[model samples]
Target: MKDRAVLYTFESVHQAIKGEDVLRAAGIACEMIPVPREISLSCGQGLRLAAADAEKSEAAWRQAAVSWQKKVHACRVDGRYRYGVEN
Candidate 1:
Protein backbone atom coordinates (compact mmCIF):
# COMPACT_ATOMS: atom_id res chain seq x y z
CA MET A 1 0.00 0.00 0.00
CA LYS A 2 1.33 3.41 -0.87
CA ASP A 3 2.25 5.65 2.06
CA ARG A 4 2.16 2.71 4.43
CA ALA A 5 4.92 2.27 6.99
CA VAL A 6 5.73 -0.03 9.91
CA LEU A 7 7.65 0.95 13.03
CA TYR A 8 8.89 -1.55 15.57
CA THR A 9 9.33 0.14 18.92
CA PHE A 10 11.73 -0.90 21.67
CA GLU A 11 12.13 -0.02 25.30
CA SER A 12 15.27 1.98 24.53
CA VAL A 13 17.79 2.85 21.84
CA HIS A 14 19.98 -0.06 22.85
CA GLN A 15 17.11 -2.54 22.53
CA ALA A 16 16.29 -1.07 19.15
CA ILE A 17 19.87 -1.64 18.08
CA LYS A 18 19.76 -5.24 19.24
CA GLY A 19 16.53 -5.79 17.30
CA GLU A 20 18.10 -4.16 14.27
CA ASP A 21 21.05 -6.53 14.48
CA VAL A 22 18.82 -9.59 14.46
CA LEU A 23 16.69 -8.27 11.62
CA ARG A 24 19.82 -7.55 9.58
CA ALA A 25 20.99 -11.09 10.19
CA ALA A 26 17.65 -12.25 8.81
CA GLY A 27 18.19 -9.99 5.77
CA ILE A 28 15.14 -7.79 6.41
CA ALA A 29 15.99 -4.19 5.55
CA CYS A 30 15.04 -1.54 8.14
CA GLU A 31 16.08 1.83 9.49
CA MET A 32 16.50 3.19 13.00
CA ILE A 33 14.36 6.28 13.37
CA PRO A 34 13.01 8.28 16.27
CA VAL A 35 9.70 7.00 17.55
CA PRO A 36 6.98 8.67 15.56
CA ARG A 37 4.73 10.93 17.63
CA GLU A 38 1.88 8.80 16.35
CA ILE A 39 3.41 6.00 18.36
CA SER A 40 4.92 7.47 21.47
CA LEU A 41 5.16 10.61 23.62
CA SER A 42 8.73 9.92 24.80
CA CYS A 43 11.95 10.17 22.79
CA GLY A 44 13.35 6.81 21.74
CA GLN A 45 14.57 4.84 18.76
CA GLY A 46 12.47 2.56 16.55
CA LEU A 47 13.13 0.12 13.75
CA ARG A 48 11.19 1.24 10.73
CA LEU A 49 10.29 -1.07 7.88
CA ALA A 50 8.03 -1.23 4.88
CA ALA A 51 4.40 -1.90 5.76
CA ALA A 52 4.53 -4.99 3.61
CA ASP A 53 7.14 -6.44 5.91
CA ALA A 54 5.53 -5.61 9.24
CA GLU A 55 4.10 -8.98 10.16
CA LYS A 56 7.05 -11.00 8.90
CA SER A 57 9.41 -8.56 10.54
CA GLU A 58 7.78 -9.02 13.91
CA ALA A 59 7.77 -12.74 13.37
CA ALA A 60 11.45 -12.64 12.58
CA TRP A 61 12.18 -10.78 15.78
CA ARG A 62 10.10 -13.18 17.85
CA GLN A 63 11.71 -16.19 16.23
CA ALA A 64 15.09 -14.75 17.11
CA ALA A 65 14.05 -14.03 20.69
CA VAL A 66 14.53 -10.29 20.23
CA SER A 67 12.13 -8.35 22.39
CA TRP A 68 10.31 -5.28 21.12
CA GLN A 69 8.04 -2.74 22.76
CA LYS A 70 5.32 -2.70 20.11
CA LYS A 71 4.64 -2.58 16.40
CA VAL A 72 2.91 0.38 14.84
CA HIS A 73 1.18 0.01 11.51
CA ALA A 74 0.39 3.07 9.45
CA CYS A 75 -1.98 3.21 6.54
CA ARG A 76 -2.65 6.06 4.17
CA VAL A 77 -5.65 8.16 5.12
CA ASP A 78 -6.45 11.61 3.74
CA GLY A 79 -3.08 11.64 2.00
CA ARG A 80 -1.31 10.87 5.25
CA TYR A 81 -0.95 7.92 7.57
CA ARG A 82 -1.45 7.73 11.30
CA TYR A 83 0.36 5.23 13.53
CA GLY A 84 -1.38 2.79 15.86
CA VAL A 85 0.10 0.11 18.07
CA GLU A 86 -0.15 -3.61 17.34
CA ASN A 87 0.86 -6.58 19.47
Candidate 2:
Protein backbone atom coordinates (compact mmCIF):
# COMPACT_ATOMS: atom_id res chain seq x y z
CA MET A 1 0.00 0.00 0.00
CA LYS A 2 2.85 2.37 -0.85
CA ASP A 3 0.75 4.43 -3.25
CA ARG A 4 1.82 2.18 -6.08
CA ALA A 5 -0.47 2.00 -9.12
CA VAL A 6 -1.82 -0.90 -11.14
CA LEU A 7 -2.71 -0.02 -14.72
CA TYR A 8 -5.05 -2.14 -16.83
CA THR A 9 -5.14 -1.36 -20.53
CA PHE A 10 -8.15 -2.56 -22.47
CA GLU A 11 -8.54 -3.50 -26.12
CA SER A 12 -11.45 -1.09 -26.46
CA VAL A 13 -13.06 1.89 -24.80
CA HIS A 14 -16.19 -0.10 -24.07
CA GLN A 15 -14.14 -2.65 -22.17
CA ALA A 16 -12.39 0.07 -20.22
CA ILE A 17 -15.67 1.69 -19.25
CA LYS A 18 -17.16 -1.64 -18.36
CA GLY A 19 -14.08 -2.47 -16.31
CA GLU A 20 -14.40 0.70 -14.27
CA ASP A 21 -18.03 -0.02 -13.51
CA VAL A 22 -17.30 -3.61 -12.61
CA LEU A 23 -14.48 -2.72 -10.27
CA ARG A 24 -16.51 0.01 -8.67
CA ALA A 25 -19.40 -2.35 -8.08
CA ALA A 26 -16.99 -4.86 -6.57
CA GLY A 27 -15.87 -2.15 -4.11
CA ILE A 28 -12.50 -1.62 -5.77
CA ALA A 29 -11.41 1.94 -6.28
CA CYS A 30 -10.26 2.68 -9.83
CA GLU A 31 -9.90 5.52 -12.30
CA MET A 32 -10.08 5.73 -16.05
CA ILE A 33 -6.99 7.33 -17.61
CA PRO A 34 -5.49 7.69 -21.04
CA VAL A 35 -3.49 4.69 -22.05
CA PRO A 36 0.17 5.28 -21.27
CA ARG A 37 2.40 6.22 -24.19
CA GLU A 38 4.56 3.16 -23.74
CA ILE A 39 1.57 0.89 -23.61
CA SER A 40 -0.08 2.02 -26.79
CA LEU A 41 0.38 4.72 -29.42
CA SER A 42 -3.29 4.92 -30.35
CA CYS A 43 -5.67 6.85 -28.12
CA GLY A 44 -7.26 4.46 -25.64
CA GLN A 45 -8.51 4.14 -22.09
CA GLY A 46 -6.98 2.40 -19.11
CA LEU A 47 -8.08 1.59 -15.59
CA ARG A 48 -5.81 2.68 -12.77
CA LEU A 49 -6.20 1.12 -9.35
CA ALA A 50 -4.24 0.93 -6.13
CA ALA A 51 -1.54 -1.74 -6.26
CA ALA A 52 -2.73 -2.92 -2.86
CA ASP A 53 -6.06 -3.70 -4.47
CA ALA A 54 -4.63 -5.44 -7.51
CA GLU A 55 -5.56 -8.94 -6.43
CA LYS A 56 -9.09 -8.00 -5.56
CA SER A 57 -9.47 -6.06 -8.78
CA GLU A 58 -8.13 -8.95 -10.83
CA ALA A 59 -10.61 -11.33 -9.30
CA ALA A 60 -13.41 -8.90 -9.91
CA TRP A 61 -12.41 -8.43 -13.53
CA ARG A 62 -12.23 -12.16 -14.10
CA GLN A 63 -15.57 -12.77 -12.46
CA ALA A 64 -17.16 -9.99 -14.45
CA ALA A 65 -15.40 -11.11 -17.64
CA VAL A 66 -14.20 -7.61 -18.30
CA SER A 67 -11.63 -8.03 -21.00
CA TRP A 68 -8.36 -6.16 -20.86
CA GLN A 69 -5.12 -6.30 -22.79
CA LYS A 70 -2.43 -5.70 -20.22
CA LYS A 71 -1.79 -5.18 -16.53
CA VAL A 72 1.26 -3.17 -15.50
CA HIS A 73 2.62 -2.37 -12.08
CA ALA A 74 4.20 1.01 -11.53
CA CYS A 75 5.93 2.66 -8.61
CA ARG A 76 6.55 6.30 -7.80
CA VAL A 77 10.21 7.13 -7.63
CA ASP A 78 11.68 10.59 -7.26
CA GLY A 79 8.26 12.00 -8.09
CA ARG A 80 8.24 10.06 -11.35
CA TYR A 81 6.57 6.78 -12.19
CA ARG A 82 8.61 3.72 -13.09
CA TYR A 83 6.78 0.80 -14.62
CA GLY A 84 8.44 -2.31 -13.29
CA VAL A 85 6.63 -5.31 -14.80
CA GLU A 86 3.54 -6.59 -16.52
CA ASN A 87 1.23 -9.53 -15.92
Measured by TM-score, the strongest candidate is 2
Q: What is the C-alpha local distance difference test score of candidate 2?
A: 0.83
Candidate 2, residues 1-87, lDDT tens digits: the string is: 245888889999999999999988888888898977887887999888878898888888889998888888877667766665532
User: What are the per-residue Cα lDDT tens digits for candidate 1 across 1-87?
Assistant: 456778878987888888899889888888898887767888999887878777787888788777898877766567765677332
The lowest-lDDT stretch of 10 consecutive residues in candidate 1 is 78-87
| Cα RMSD, each candidate | 3.1, 2.3
Error of 2 at 2 (Å): 4.4
Score each candidate by Cα lDDT: 0.79, 0.83
- How many clashing pairs does model 2 include? 0
Which residue pairs show backbone clashes in model 2?
Answer: none
Top lDDT hit: 2
